[model samples]
Target: MPPQLVLASGGGWGAAPKMENGQPVPGEFVVPNGVPVGSVAYFQVGNPNPSYVITTVTWDGGTDIKGYMSGTPTSAPAKKQEVLTGVAKNQTSYTFVVKAEAKNYTVRADVQYANGAKGWVTVEFASVRPTTTLAVPEDKVGFQATGDTNTHNVAGLVQAIFFQATATTHQHGGSFIFMQLVKSARVESAYFENNKLVKEYIENDRSIPNGEDFDGKLHDDFLNRLAYLHIYDGNIMYGWHLMPGRSMPVPAAPPGGTPDPPMMFDDPKSQVPLDWIGNAFTSSFSTYLMYKPQSGVWVALNQIDWSVSQAATRTGPGGTWEALTLPAPTQVSQPSTPNGMAAFPTWVNFTSNFINDQLNPWRPLD
Candidate 1:
């Protein structure tokens, strides 16, 4: 009978090569295709026969990996892969590096017993290429994150770029007063396995104080807004960054806080609405102030009427529409209402009466 084969190398994960369909075949290992071009995968095989010699190891997809970059490998590798004719079977293995065009591959090693018997072992591994629709460089294959709530998710497919990403503006509508206003925020983006975010990505991005998001936007105007969840001292904190290393005005509880409820940005409340996304339109309301707070309300109300008359007209799908109730402003502005927007609430207290009653109410996903 052939001797047993054992694996003892790092960077490899798979069942030992076994008899499949009555032939020696290596077990399969799955790896993301979105990996660094030169990333190395290592594997070793142990021979049960103490008196045997490994003859050869061959990698099919590695003909050009040897000296493609940085010149040739300096000395013989500690692990034997090629030219193993006289090498002891116990102390040898094979290693291969990823290339730009890598794909499914297998390695085979030939061995000979002291008594002139011949046998062989085979191992296999696979590469799961990135989604070509959102292709990213292989080297950028690490956990990445981006989003705040007023914007979109930031991501990269080509660079380890250090670009500015900001959300720091709260003009009128939205209730993220404390969440906006991040200046000089730098973010790096890379592809992770899938949308399934893990603690590794969270903690890694948080430590750097910079990162990117889904659409590949890495500029100072990076505006992907996502309800953020963080990890601190082994606790998951649900909240957003007002700036670098700070929390949003009204932060959320961490994981396990509500038994079985997933974070807002992750599950049921994942789809944030556009109308509910941006800050309120407060131009008319600001102009109302010129009429005095008491008159400001009336002036603002009237301005709506005037605007309704001149513009901002729309026809519903069912051929329905509503007329402007208040008069349009003659000199200044008014506060935003269900019909029109004029002013920005000085601050946002999402749970306060002002927000729930007067200011934009459809905000801060529950």
Candidate 2:
């Protein structure tokens, strides 16, 4: 009888063996008539006759399969056959083609079967890209100093006077003038005269003699004088002088002696020659006399503190001194005063030693 083949319990079929003398036969078996890409295939072999030796069951082109099976069945034509399992090596040679869109990729897998059959399948995956963002620019702010306006060309002189005043008795108090220069604005120059804004005149003529009096002239000329002197002159000085009433007595004759013969006021010979004598009186007195003389003899006096000159020294019981004490109310207090009213007291306060310390060389009495 020919060897009978039967379907296996494991969803596979077994091949009929060639038989002789009613004995079992052996043959090779192949599995998976067709293998899909990414799919696994399995198979089994059986030997019944003890003398029927089982040889190798080889698989061809099973490289793409993911798993394997092998076993020798104990009973011939049994209902169930046990399969020995093995792993299929990954098929590196199998090519998987992929198509990509903006955010995803599609992969098609083609598989070659052991029996020269091939299969294909497709799968999808995701893709991504990178991203970024940035920022903007901004503006700036600040200030600048512009000096006096009255004297358009004497900023340096103004500064010098300011420093001098500050160094002396002028308190650290005064107004400041300034302006803002916007982006890229150039500063041509700045003139500072008593906190007034003047045209910038950095390089023009800047000479200002100490006592070169200014008459009622051009406003610019008056301002130039003020700038050079750092002291208000002209009408400003007039008001300033009047503010402090005269304190010194007119020069007189010696006790019970005759007064010096009056010289014609207009006579150059009769008029007392003006001089820059030093230490003639107390600073206040000298200052008043220096600018507002009463007679040939210098006398102590006062003013509204616009500016004044005075004796180089005043004698005290201790010794001859060389400093001047500025009066209080250093600045002008009001715009007007009663007619004939003195800004300060009328009586002059001279110590007993005042007469002996006179530094003037040509005192009328002397």
TM-score of every prediction relative to native: 0.26, 0.13
Candidate 2 per-residue lDDT over residues 1-366, each given as its tens digit: 111122211112122333457663333222212111111223322233334333322223222212211111111111111212233323322222111111332323343444444433322323211110000001101011223232211111111101111001011111111000001101122223465433221111111233221111111111212111122211112111111221111134567442221110000000011221112211111011111111111111221122222222223222333334211112221112111112111221111111112311121211
* Model 2 ranges off by over 4 Å: 1-320, 324-331, 335-366
Q: What is the C-alpha local distance difference test score of each model?
A: 0.25, 0.19
**For each candidate, how many residue pairs have backbone atoms clashing (under 3 Å)?**
46, 15
Angstrom error at residue 103, model 1: 1.7
What is the Cα-based TM-score of model 1? Answer: 0.26
lDDT, residue 148, candidate 2:
29
* lDDT per residue (tens digit) for residues 1-366 in model 1: 243446523222344434558774443322322222223445464456567654443323332232111111122111111211122223356554433233555555555566676665555545322111111123322212223231221111111111111122121111111111111111111122345321111100121212212111111111222212323334554322232222222234785342322111111011112222111111111111101010011111111111101111113212212222212222211212211122111111111111112222222211
